[model samples]
Each structure stands twice: as structure tokens, then as C-alpha cells.
Target: MTRTATIIGGGVIGGGWAARFLLNGWNVQVFDPDPQAERKINAVLSNARLALPALSDVPMPVEGKLSFHDTIFDAVQGSEYVQESVSERIELKKKVYAQLQQANPGVLIGSSTSGFKASDLQEGSPAPENIIVAHPFNPVYLLPLSEVSGSPRNTTETVERTAQIMRDIGMYPLVIRKEIDAFIGNRFLEAVWREALWMLKDGIATTSEIDEAIRMGFGLRWGQMGLFETYRVAGGEAGMRHFMAQFGPALKWPWTKLMDVPEFNDELVDLVANQSDAQSGAYGIRELERIRDQNLVGFLRALKERNWGAGKVLRDHDAARAAVFHAQTDTAPKAEPLTMAHMQVLPGWIDYNGHMTESRYYFANSETVDAFLRLIGAGMDYVAGGHSYYSAETHIRHLGEAKLGDRLVGTIQIISADEKRFRSFVRIMKGDEVVATVEQLCLHVDMAAGKTVAASPEVWANLKAIAEGHAGLALPEGAGRAVGQKK
Candidate 1:
């Protein structure tokens, strides 16, 4: 079933969330009071057009309906989920909720408030259970850090459901078990900020120096493993207990005022802002933000593959989204991945021309086979060294055409195997239906003198075996067509 999410405010975070969900295939209804709502949303759509379609690990899930609404109620009229990202004021939030409750009573309501406790935010609501803090970090599409909190009874379900939704849309949702002012992460940052201010005031360190301390040292560790996990590694072979035994004594040392809070005043605010302006003035806000997003995407994708917590979430989300895409599109099941060599197409490969592009089809088939050869240790170097190459000598008659919306596959089967030469017959099929047959002759060439030559002993032997096994494939029916052709 297609999901409809009503986005209440089409500002930066909301726009980003819009992009994320829209990319993951959710239809969105956007409502923002600002007269510039269309321009704001279209800007986000422009980014999503480039960003979402590029994540082609799977045919990206169904894109949601993105329509601008005159009022919040219109946006929420039939939404499964409602994400409110209007201005963050207690009174403003209450008004939004009251308006939202009047629109739809049971649909989940997520506030984009970063710091407000759910208790305070949901107070006096007709159904406070429905509203929860789904506080997302800035550039929500990229950072993926979100803190979700609500009243004890409903918060867990709300968090779990929202997190699942976030995962589907490729966001990291961190649930706060208990709500506190600003929640756990920012509260911790608040503590550090209070102390860091004193250092700035005292001229103990430059702004860059404090930031460098974290970025160069601890921040690298923070991306993969959280502070606690990294500290456990520091404990040595004995782990956290042994490390605590050694370093617990350092608690007595007078390290800086990590516990004290500094006074916040005009002078301090100006001092910090000036320092920030100095640090960042080399680039505009837009450029700086783009650089940050690209870096975060790289780090997040890397960590995700290692099955670290955040990475695990990303991987699971990826798989889930892929399944959703396949199901929605009714894409046919692909052949088992090419452990040896194969080419299979899901429905999305079909083009508007009613046939797959010739170049893309070739590219897809070659990559599938390349992946197989790579697993057996014959990759770029194996061919580039000019020792082994497959030359398409002849492509026979097309048995049938693969239509625009058909699931098709192709396979290359070896016909003959020799140390110096090899032959293969290729078949393109639409399910059980054969569409085309290709026959190719290959040679081991040593381009040292631009001449055909034998490959390395080990490589030739490995190739000979795989080739011999596939040589028995019933010679692709049109094999004789190219036999009498001139060079």
C-alpha cells in the first residue's frame, strides 16, 4: 500500500524530510503558512530529483505524491503520518496539535522539535498519546540522527513505528527511553558547551583547537563506535573492567571544570558567534553544508557496511526499501547472483522506448559476468595485462524481442576451452523464452608486442577449468551463422 505523509512545514528540516521520504517512495502532502512554500518545496524537489534517483542500489521505492496544500488540514486530510516542523514554540506547537487533532485523530503526529520534552509539548492535548517529539538533526536527509520521545506508555510504540518508518526512508532514528529537556544527546552537548565557553573566555584554546581536539582525536572513533564502545576497546584485552581498574583512579585528578556551567550572556554569545564566523567565512553556508553532507554520506555508508549499529540500521533499511520497491513495481525475481557468470534484469531496466538500451543491456550483462570472474580473482588486471580478452566475433539472429516491461536474463556459456583460445555462446532470454544468441571467440593476448600470446600458467589453468565445465551447454542454436563469415 502506498503511504501518504502530510508534512506541515516545508522549511529546511521539513524539506529534507520530504526529500528523504519522497525518495524512499512516499507520497507527501506539504503545508506551510509561508507564502513562498512552492518555491521552498520545489527547491527540495530539485535536490531530491538528483539525490534520490542516484541511490539505485535497488530501483528506488515508489516516490510519494508531493502536492502543496493551502492549509495544514488539507495536507493532513488523508495522511497516514503527519510530521509537523513549524516554528518551535510551546504555544505554537499546541496550536498545531489542536489543529492537527481536528484534522485526523488517530494518525501519528511527530514534532520536529529538537529539545522540547514530549511532556511539555503534548500537554493539554485531546490525545497527547498521538503527538511525540520526532526531533531530527539538521539536514535530516543526510545526518540521519533523530531523537524520538513521548509519554512513557505510547512513546515506545511511537518511537518503534517512527524508527521503522525512518529506516524505510533511510534515516537513523534514536529513541530516548526517558524524556529530559533537550533529551540525552543535546543535553550532553550542552554540558560540553558550558565548559568550552569558559575556555574561550579565558583564552585557554583557540576555537579551532577545541574543535580539532574532538575531530582529530575522539570524533573519528565516535562515527563507528560510540564513546562507551571505544572506551571499552581502550581497556585492552581485558576490556572495560580492566581499563576502569587502571584509569578509574584518574577520577581524583583535577582535570578541567567538566562539571561546572558557565554563565550565558551577550558578551559570550557575541564572542562565540565571531569565532564561528571567522572559522567558516571562507565558504558560503550553502557550500559548507554541501561539503558536510557529502562527508557524512561517505562516513555513514562506510560504517553501515561493517554492521555497526548505525550501519546495521542503514543496511536493514536498504534491504527493506529494496523489497518494497520490488513488491510495488511487481518486478520479477532475478536470477541468483552471478557466482560464476550471469545477467538478469528486474522490471525497472525497461526504458521508455519499449526496449532496454543496447549499451545499458551490454553494460549490465558484462558487469554481472565480471562480478563472477572477480570472485574467482580474475578482474581488471586479468584482462588489462593484455593476456586474456573476449572479442565479439559474431552476434546471431534475435530470437525474440524483450519488451519494455518484461523481466529478462542473459547468460554466457563456454563452448570450447584452450590455454590460448576460448569460445562462448551467449543467450538472452525473457524468462523461459530465448530472445537472442551471441557467439564470441576470445584469445590470450600479450600486448607487449601487440600480439596474441598465452596467459600466465595459473590464470590459464583456472580459466581452462571454468571454460571446460560450461563448454557442454547445448551450442546456442545460431552458432553456425558466424562460422563462414569473412574477417
Candidate 2:
């Protein structure tokens, strides 16, 4: 069943919520009094369109409908979920919640308030049991973390159901067992932010230097292992317990001014703003955002390769998406020479020659194999069961070049197959032109035993059927070609 989400207050956070829901196949309705709400949300959606899909190889669900409304009642009337992202003002939030409840008494309400606790949001609500804090970080479409908390009045079911919904939309819902100010993530962020501010106030570091300190050092570590685990590694052979024992004495060293607040008067504000401008004002905000998005894509892809931390989240999400794709395609008529893959050449795939590099052709062919594996029901579960196809031999012929941003598609024709072995040829095309071809030989492996094995009866039957269906087609022109002629 299609789901609907209504967003109130189409600012950065609200726009992000819209993107997250809409891209995940939820019809989104947005209500913001500001005249520029539509334009701002559209801009966020544009960035999301580029960044989100690049995170996974599996195809995403088709986008849901998005409609902008002038009033809260119209937006929330039929929505199953209502996300409130208006200003941080307490009374404003209360007003919105009241309106939302009046509009749809049974719908769940989640507030995108980074600072307010769920109890605070529930203070004046008529339907407090349905309201929860679903605070998400900026660029919510890309980042998976969402801090969720429910008030005392909220039922346990509400929180769990909200968490499941968040997971469906590719978000990690970190539920706060008890409500507290700033939730969880922002508390840690606040500590760092306060230290940075104090450093700036004391003239110890410029904005760029502070940013460099994090990005060039701890930021990379935090992306995967986080602070405590990184420090655990620092403990040598002892691990986290010993590390804390060794470093615990420094707690009173006055190393941080966590309790101090720098006055936000004009002089300090100007000083910080001026330094920030001098540091990064060369590029406009959009360019900086694009650079940030590209860097995130590359970093996340690296982490995905290792299946660690956020990368693990991405891998699991990809598997789920692939499962859905397999289910949908399994019932549909199989296209002869199955269209196994379709994707644009990502920026990282390009070379100095302004075209996709040689290695990427192999990467594309590997993706075709993955898609084919899923199509035949030998997917994640099959691999998990200690059997999988291992490539034994491959021959590739690069016939043409593909540039960045070119849409590439791969089609596979089964050349031969049996219980223990399969061989296939994959042709990659840029539109109608053949860009490359790879002929691959694969053996079914009992992974634990480290040797070839016959595939299960079901898998063998599926492969045999596909091979027989394509038996009448003519052999590809270069099917048997070698590097040297018979001269």
C-alpha cells in the first residue's frame, strides 16, 4: 500500500523530510506559510535526486507524488504521518500540533525539533499519545540517523511503529528510552560545538584550522569506529576498559571549557563570520554543497565496501531494495537477453581521458552478474547459506568509450549452463552503441569447503530454463574471438 506523509514548515529540515519520504515512495504533502517554501523544497529535492541513489547499486522505488498546500488542515487531512518542522518556538509548535490533531485525530505526529524533548512537545497537545520527537540531522535525505523519543503519554506501539516507518524510508531510528533535552546525537555535537566556539573565542584556531583538525584527523575515524572504539584501538592490547582506566585521570585537567558560553555580541559574531568567509567564501554555497555531497558519496561507498558502521546500514538497505526488485521482476515476463543493469557513469568512474576508465567496464559487468544472481533467486539468502558463484575466468573486449553522465545498460545472454558451472556473455551499451562485452565463466562453490559443487535443484532448473529460452538466438559476432588472429 502507498503511504502518505505531510510536512509542515518547509525549511531545511522539513524539506529534507519531504525528500526522504517522497524518494522512498511515500506521497508527500507540504504546508508552509512562507511563499518561497516550494522553491526551497525543490532545491533540496534536486540535491537529493543526485546524492541518495548514488549510495546504493540497487534500484530505488519510483518516486511518490509531491504537492504543496497553503494550509495545515489540507496537508494533514489524509496523511498517515505528519512531521512538524516549523520554527523552534514552543507556542508555534503547540499551535501546529493542535491543528494537526484536529485535522486527523488518529494520524501519528513527529516533531523535527532538535532541542525540545518529546515531553516538551506534548505539554499542550490534545492527542499527546500520538506525538513524538523524530529529530533528524541536516541533509536528512542522505544521513540515516533520526533520534526518536516519545513522551510519557505515548504508547510503546507508537514509537515502534514510527521506528519501522523510518526504517522503511532508509533511516536509522535511534530511540531514546527516556526523554531529555537535545536528545542524544546533538548532545555530543553540542560538546564539540562548544569547544570549537571557545577555541575561536580564545584565538587558538581559525574556522578553517578547526575544521581541518576534525576532517583531517578524527572525522575519518569517527565515520567508521567512532570515538570510544577509536580510543579502544589506542589502548594497544588492552581495549576500551584499559583505555578508560589510563585516560580517566585527565578528566579534571581543565582541558575543555564545556561550561563556558562565549557572548554572542556583535564583535564576536563578526569575527567568526569574517573568518569563515575568508576560509571558504571562494565557492558559493551550492558549489560547496555539491563538493560535500560528492565527498560523502565516495566515503560512504568506501565504508560500504567494508560493511562497517554507516556502511553496514547502506549494505543492509541495498539488500532490502534488491529483494523488493527481485520480487517485482520475478513475476514479470523475462526480457530475452535480460536487461540486467542500468546506471549513469558516476563521476568517480571517469579517467583523465574524460571517459569511463577500463576498470569500470569490469565493475559494470560484475553488477550484471549480481542482478542475474538475484533474478534466479540465488541472492543474499543463498550466499548466506554458504554457496555462491565464483568467477573462474573472464575475457573482455572494450569496443568503445563512455563518458561521465552517459547512461549505460547491460544485457546478458546465457551461453551455456549446467549444475556445477555456468558461462555467460554480457554486452554493455551506451544507448544503442555497444561499448564493451565480457564473457565470464563461473563455478558454483561450496564456500566453506572451498571447492566447486553442483547448484541446488531449484537454482539449476532456473538457469537451464533461461539458457533454453535463448538457445535459438544467433551467436554474438565476437563470441569466440581471441587476442590474436589465426594468421
Candidate 3:
């Protein structure tokens, strides 16, 4: 059965929520009074379709249906989950909730409100337990954090179910211990925003300078290690306690205006807005959003390569999806080449010629071959058992170009196999076009003994069965061609 999620607004954050849920295989129903909601949400989904899949190694779920509705009742008709991204007015939110409850009293609603507490929004609601805070940062399709805040009225089941739903859509649900206005992330951001505003109001720094301070310095640290860990590393040999004791006195230095509110007059607003425009207003808003999404893809992909921070959430999600994929297809040898891997051409994969770089072609081949190995039970677990397959020689031929955002399928043919060695061919395809081919010979080796060795009985049976299955098929064109050989 296809799951459905109803989105109550269609602004930047709401559109992001729609993309996130839709891309994760949930049919999305949206309700917003704005005439341009569909166009705006489609714009967000376009960026999402490019960036989100780049973060995964396994195939993403087939996207679900998206529909725009005129009324809350229509949108929330059959959706079990509802993400309310409407404006931050309490009465307006309550009004939306009343309508939602009327349509489906049991529907779980997650608010995208950054400031409103769940208790405040739940006031006078017939189904208060069903309403909870699931505030997310901007670019919700990419960023993983979703602060799941609940009040005392909420049951433990409600909170856990909300968190699980967020996780199901590939989000990190940081359940707040206590309800607080703005939750965690926005509160810290508000402090920083206040300080930055003070600096602009006092003419101490331009908006660009403050942003540079962040993206250039601590932002990089916070991206991976976060605050306390970064400070612990900054403590030389002693760690966090020593560092805090040493620098804790600086709290009284009055170097920051965090406690002071900068006057919110038009003068301050104009100062910040004018400077910001001068800094980044060359590009249109959509262009800036695309640039931001691309940069984030590169950054998050690096973290994924290292398996750290938000990247871990991505990896976990991919693993879960891969589990389902493998379960659906048994380990038996197929009559044709096994579809071993699926991938997207990420931003980092492209080069100066606007084609996928040479290294990624090899990476694609490795991904396919690795999946085949895993299927045959000679994967990382086998390596940990002190035996593994090592590639002996490789020949790659590039036939066509693959550019950024191109979806690629990798299929592997087992040419021949024995106890100790096998030859495999991989075809990297974009739709019906074969863009590249990689042929390689691999040797099973005893790692401790540092020599060729026979494969385990189970693994050899699987590999041998696969090789035998391909024995009747004609050899792939250019399978044994040399570097300069003619077609």
C-alpha cells in the first residue's frame, strides 16, 4: 500500500517537506491558498530530484504521486500523517488543526513552526495528542535534522510514532526533552542572529563578513564534530573540562551582544538587507537555491564517504533500502547479467568537459563488482574471515558520456569462474545507452597467508552457478580488446 502525507502549506519549508516525503515513496497531498504553490513546490522538487539521490548508493524509491487540493479536507482525506507548514500564527494553526481533526481525527500532524510550542498549538484541540512539533531546517529534503518536540499532553506512543515517521523519510528526529519556544536549532540560531544583527547595527561587520566568519571557520568544525567535540579537540591534551575551565571566564567579557536586542527598526533592516543584496543578489533566488543545493550535495557526499554525521543517516537509510532490495531478489544466479548497482551522476562526478570524470567510471565498476561479491558471500565478512577477492587486472573502455544527474545502471556478467579466480564484465548504462564497460580478472586470496586460495564451498557454488548461467551467452563486444585495438 502506498503511504500518503498531507502538507498544509506550500512555501519554501513546506515545499521541501513535500519533496522529502514524495521522494521517499509517499504520495503527497498539498493544501495552500496561494495560487503559485504548485509551481514553487515543483521548483523545490527539481533541486531535490538532483541532490537527494546523489547522497545514496542504492537505488532511491520510485517517487510517489503529488497532488494539490483546494481545501484541508480534500488534502487530508486519507493521509495518516500530516505535516503542517502553514504560517506561524497560533490562531491560524489552530484553525488548520481543527479542520484537520474534523477530516481525520486520528491523523498525526507535525508542525513546521519554528517558534510555537506544541502545547500552545494543541490548546482547545480535541486531539491534542496527535499534534506535535516536527520543526525542520530549510532545504528539508537534504538536511536530516527534524526536532520532534512534544508537550505533556502527548503520549509516548505519539512521540515515538512521530520520530519513526521522520526516520522513515530519512530524517534525524532529535526529540526534545522539554518543550521550549523555537526548539533547539532555532534558539541557537536566534542567539547568533541577534549577535549578527547587533554587529550590523553597530557597523562592526557587514553581513558578508559575518557569513564568511561562519562558512570559513567554525561552520566547518560544526558540520562534522559539532560544538562540544570541536571544543574538546581544541583543548590541546586535557579535553572539554580543561578547556571550559580555562575559557569559561570569558563569558563575562561582554564581547557578544547575545543578550541585547538590536533595535528592529527599518534602519537596521535596510542596513542588513542592502549589504546582503550587494553581497549575493547577483543571482536570482532560484539560482542561489540551486547553487546552495549543489554545494550541500558535495559537502554531504564527502561526509558520506567518511560515514560521519548526517551522512550516517543517509547510509543507514540506503542500507535499509538495500536490505529490502536484496530480499526481493534472491541470491540465485540469473539468466542474464545481474543488475548489481544503481547510481546517479553527482555534482562532484563531473569534470571540466561537463562529463563524468574518469575515476567515477572506475568507481561505478567497483560498485557493481562489489555488489556481486556481496551477493556471492565473498564480501566484507569474507575479508574479515581472512580471505577475499583482489582485482588482478582491469580494462575499461569509454563509449559515451555521462553528465551530472544522469541515472546509471550497472550490470555484471560472470565470464568464467573457478575456486581461485574469475573474470567479470560490467556494463555501465544510462537508459538504453551503454556509456562504459569494465572487464576485470579477480583472484581469491588467503589474506593471512598472502597467496591465492580456493573460495569457500558456499561462495564457489554461487560463483560457479553464475558463471555457468552466462556460459551460453555470446561474449560482450570489446570484452578482450586491447587499449588501441580497433572495433
Please tell me which predicted candidate would have the highest TM-score against the true structure.
3
1-487: candidate 2 lDDT, tens digit per residue: 8899999999989999999999788999999999999999999898887788778666567689999998888999779999999999989999988888998898898999989988888886777899899999878988888899888788889999999988989888999988889988899999998899889989999999999999999998998898888999988898888888999999979898898889889988888899999999999876887788878888888988999877888898888876765553332224368887775676567788879899989998998888888777788899999999999989898889898557787788888899999889999989899999999999999999999999989888888888887787777768867776441
User: Cα lDDT of all candidates, in order?
Assistant: 0.69, 0.86, 0.92
Give per-residue CA lDDT, model 3, range 295-369, as digits (tens).
888888889888999889988898887776666533678778888887777666889887999999999999889
Candidate 2 or 3, higher lDDT? 3
Superposed model 1: Cα runs more than 4 Å off: 44-56, 153-159, 325-363, 366-487
TM-score of 2: 0.81
Looking at candidate 3, what is the lDDT of residue 480?
Answer: 93
- By lDDT rank, best first, the candidates go 3, 2, 1
Model 3's number of clashes is 0
For every model shown, the clashing-pair count is 6, 0, 0
- Clashing residue pairs found in predicted model 2: none
Candidate 1 residues 192-277, lDDT tens each?
78778888988887678889998899989987888789989999899999989999999899876877766778988888888988
Candidate whose lDDT is highest: 3
Steric clash pairs (candidate 3):
none
Alpha-carbon deviation at 163 in model 2, angstroms: 1.1
Q: lDDT (0-100) at residue 35 of candidate 3?
A: 100
